[model samples]
Target chain A: MAGRRVIPGFGLSLGFTLFYLGLLVLLPLAALVVKASSLGFAGFAQVLGSPQVQAALRVSFVSAAIAALGNGLFGLLLAWVLVRYRFIGRRAIDALVDLPFALPTAVAGIALATLYAPQGWIGQWFARADIQIAYTRAGIVVALTFVGLPFVVRTLQPVLLDLDAEVEQAARSLGASRWQTFSRVILPALVPALITGMTLAFARAAGEYGSVVFIAGNMPGQTEIAPLVIMTRLEQFDYAGATAVGAAMLAVSLLLLLAVNLLQAWTRRKLGGA
Target chain B: MAFHRILRSFTALALITAALLTQIAGCSSKDGDTAQPGTSLTLLNVSYDPTRELYKEVNAAFADDYRRKTGIDVRIEQSHGGSGKQARSVIDGLQADVVSLALGYDIDQIAAKASLLPADWQCRLPCNSSPFTSTIVMLVRKGNPRAIRDWGDLTRQGVSVITPNPKTSGGARWNYLAAWAFAQRNGRDPREFLAALYANVAVLDLGARGSTTTFVQRNIGDVLLTWENEAYLALKEFGADRFEVVVPSISVLCETPVAVVDTVAMRHGTRNAAEAYLQFLYTPQAQDIAARHGFRPRDASVAARYADKFAPLVLVGIDSFGGWPQAQARHFAQGGLFDQLYGGR
Candidate 1:
């Protein structure tokens, strides 16, 4: 605490922190709210009321939720395995986890398109098996999962690594089974991190465009997601329409993820007490 | 060693940050430059793919002669993407002074939003403001195994044709319109033709270049409905023997429009240079160069220069269908015939 006196101190640090966050995040978001508000109530109702808009909202939310949920489950397992035990090429596997983050979205889209098109490698197999993926809603989910996995794994890795082992032992000593130790003792400690990871993954997947477009076939009201709808509006030079859709998406996405945030806060309160 | 290691890590981090910042900043400044009075005005022509060679030769000539006449620096910066996407970027405030996209409808979109163009913008310049025109043709593998002679051949089952999404790619619209126009001309219902043709499509790509790459480069599909210039470039690049260009008995005229982004022109005070740049595109020299790139020259006299290269055919204008606007509204526009076909399917 005394060392803080040598630094910028409490007042200046607090002011600088707020200023930085305001400039980087709040200012842009405020602009969106202001710009969107300019559409007025009647205009917004018309934009949101369109059947195409509703379809896009459904596709964006459902696909993003599916991808984030898939990531949370698999990412937890991958993070746990990496941390709890040793393995060959562990560093290489860890590096591979970050590939989606590093690869350009357009390049990823092109690669996914090539890999999943009807005549392409995996598509050939799927075609033979009579299970279609590319140019379908399933392709959108696959691309979203591919891009959002890194967020969950990276978030959960440290949480799992730092988890206290004695809690599990203590639970077992109380005659609790292994499943009980995991479910009751260890899982509570991980809830905040898991929820946070899921929220980030969902947000990332919701706005994703490039990777999905190639695989989606861009058929309106079919594989078209909300971002594609916005892109379509933009292409048509429908500025009001694009922003109208974007603002509606903003509201729905915030509402959809409110539960995860509340869960995170609850977990934080529990962890603080522990 | 410890000090060197720390220095190396800091240097690497700085380099990465610099690289990323440079890229972000490069896209940030759309176009903010003015030639001092009496200096050359550099014109940036951000175009779609395959214009690299065409623009290189045309810009060189424009710089020399424009400098000779007006002493302006005529620089053309052409970037290509799927046409509709490119037009969307332009509309989303890409600082393009002049846009020559793959279709006229995209230019009309810019005009609608920015009020940067006249109602008859395409006709503002010579030859309906296009200065050059292309036609859609079937790009088949060497020997043309599909034996596809016209648009009707594509409707046969299991054809596995490839085209870019019409909603996104300007070139793809021409492909869509050509098929639609042919169906209408042949007295077949547009929906019937469209449903069958779309069913034959195995893949939909981002733009003409992407679709062409899949067809010519990867050798994927039976027939690729592509821009004539792209087919020519493919033949020129990938040996003419490697692929065959099958001109459909009838095809839609792909007229690309060029225009100055007006507000940008007013702000930059490059109005004279911008207008001059567009007019220069129609000159015999430019038209001949366009013909070389497989675009039919706007000038009949200049087109004769490449007479040996062009195959004889009756060129049909959109005048038969009341030009582009009506054609677009009737065939491909939202709630148009496309939806009638795709919706039912």
Candidate 2:
């Protein structure tokens, strides 16, 4: 097997990867599935069909999607700015991009909640207009956006740095306008990375608990997120019901990410072939 | 170079794995030492939030008394969280020798789920096993800008209220029941009153401390529904110039219950110490300490000594609402009054 291998120690590395993945990821997921199955199909259906559960799932998915979309656009602009331009505090800004990753999620939740509460520094202005932010659906989106920002910015930064400026120069030398050059050339080149970043951000936001709970008021059927609902069920000592909700969330997230990855792969292949 | 990179990565992974294994080993070895015969005994007291100060005083006093009496060095470890969360941790094997929680229902959950104590465990101590009691009171901004004086004022349109989620917080359950009791006493429909009052709630925090932070630090709501001790603590900590305590005309007596976990105490062979520790809470000295810390002492003389500190008000007990089990099932359970009030919104 060693003689036939294209790479040396492939067997060892593969074994290590499988062992680590199985121990950390697959085993816990399998346990969750088993726990959920104890509820039976009808019981699972009943858990998902509850109006409060349905409302929480909607809040989680919709707010996560909006946050991911916001990150996609702003994150690309930030990556482009950092890659293509030199500024006074370029190194400082680059380091700051990873702040969300280093900060604890609960701290971020509390900070965000404080900053957006009605009497807070920024919230007082919004309060004047009678538009509430903290303890509302919009507050959940803000916290998710804070935690998910780094995924997009960090993922696109490397890709943006690798992009050749000569391609854009050539487009400019031709008759293509700025919009056409960006849409036809630069955007197509970045689509695969952008989608990857957005998918990661969306998945993270969907499962976020600590940050959202602090700001989300947690009014059932109004601002409660799916993860909080699972926690609430667990607190009620309804383990099977909690796992059933968790399994449903896991299935949906997996399918959605799978679809996004498939799209990214297709785009990559077409561009490479072209 | 590729082989060197792989080797370096594997070395790092091995170091991380070794570190994690050592931590786990350290935890198990510590657990093993509890059963060994020794002159010194350690007990874990799982309690709810807002009782940290009260317990700090009680534990220190108890430790000194125990040392003087039995000459046994007793170390009491304290764990605090939302009462229901604390109870859940006990049920999930937290090895709590005693549970001093914000409400009796939380202790009842542990009784039903983990068999830590029998269902009639509350009968072991006097006053339904509640050493000290508090009541639901209002904390308002200084000068009472909203002029909110009673539960009815909380339902006014422009007044925003702050309280925790009842499902997760034992203190919030008392707040919810207090409002219900007040409404009923006032000849108003309890359900309608609750619905209107909750509508005025700008935020339903996860626990009592979170609600306090929202009301005091963040300054979000016009009024806060919280435990009587918590209100006084906020007033003392934040200064009377910034906050004021309002004793409503009628409120529910928020009894904080203490009980020994028989299974845990027996397992650790610390049953005697655990029972003695709880029994100590009922002493006149401990009751005085409870009163000084803003709780209504159960001991009549100690309570009278601090009567000037607490305002006079009518307090309905949990028995009037058919006890903890029925109240828990009817009011705070899923699809109960709480769910109908907030979920329907």
Best prediction by DockQ? 2
The pairs that clash in candidate 2 are: none
Q: Write the per-residue lDDT of candidate 1 for residues A1-274, one digit (tens) a residue.
A: 6346755346646777999999998887788777767879997787777666677788888999999999999989988888888889998999999999999997998788778766778888997988878777888998999999999999998988888878788899999998888887888878888888888999999999988877775655567789887876665555677788888888877886887677778778887787
Residues B97-132, candidate 1: write the lDDT tens digits.
788877777787777766766666776777677888
**Per-residue accuracy of model 2 over B1-345 as CA lDDT, tens digit each:** 677898999999999999999997775455432333336778999999999999899998998898788777789999999888899999999999999999888899899998889999889999999999999999999999999999999998889999998878888899999999988989999999999999888888889999999899988889999999999999889999999988899999888899999998887777888898999999998999888889999898998889899888999999999998899788876667777876631
What C-alpha lDDT values do all the predictions have? 0.78, 0.90
Off by over 4 Å in 2: A3-9, A269-274, B1-38, B343-345
Model 1 ranges with Cα > 4 A deviation: A1-27, A30-46, A49-51, A118-132, A169-178, A263-274, B1-39, B67-73, B82-93, B109-112, B117-124, B214-221, B237-242, B260-276, B325-334
Which structure among the candidates has the greatest lDDT?
Answer: 2
Worst 10 residues of 1 chain B by lDDT: B28-37
Q: On residues A201-244, what C-alpha lDDT tens digit does candidate 2 reach at each position?
A: 99999999988889888888889999988987876778898999
DockQ of 2: 0.48
Fnat values, one per model, are 0.26, 0.60
CA shift at A109, candidate 2, in angstroms?
Answer: 1.0
